[model samples]
Target: MRKKRRQRTILWCAIAAAIIIALLWTEQIALLYVLATLGLTILMLIVAFADLEGAKRSGQATDD
Candidate 1:
């Protein structure tokens, strides 16, 4: 599960970066920055929760 999660994380992050670059290449809209920021924030949240849950389930956390 953790390996799958890691793969998905990398895939989604790459996808997000591609989209941002595509948008930048096609247009110089200021909104693109906002969209990129939101995308990055979402990716960060996914990574954070994934690691936390994995650690907890594996009893790797201090409180576990």
Candidate 2:
């Protein structure tokens, strides 16, 4: 589970970095920064939720 979580985290981080770079190079749109910020915030929320779910599952396994 941990190994999977680590892989997911790395994947998300790489995706976020790639999106940020792409946004920077694409155009000079005023909302580019805002779009990047929103994208990052959503990615972080997803990663955090996955971590919480993993913890809950691990805890339940130990309890049983």
TM-scores for every candidate against the unseen true structure: 0.51, 0.49
Writing each residue's lDDT as its tens digit, candidate 1 over 1-64 gives 9999999999999997888788889896687978868879999999877767666679854652
Count of residue pairs whose backbone atoms collide, per candidate: 0, 0
Candidate 2 lowest-lDDT run of ten: 55-64
What TM-score does prediction 1 earn? 0.51
- Model 2 per-residue lDDT at 53: 73
- How close to the true structure is residue 55 of candidate 1, measured as C-alpha lDDT? 66
Question: Model-by-model lDDT, in order?
Answer: 0.83, 0.81
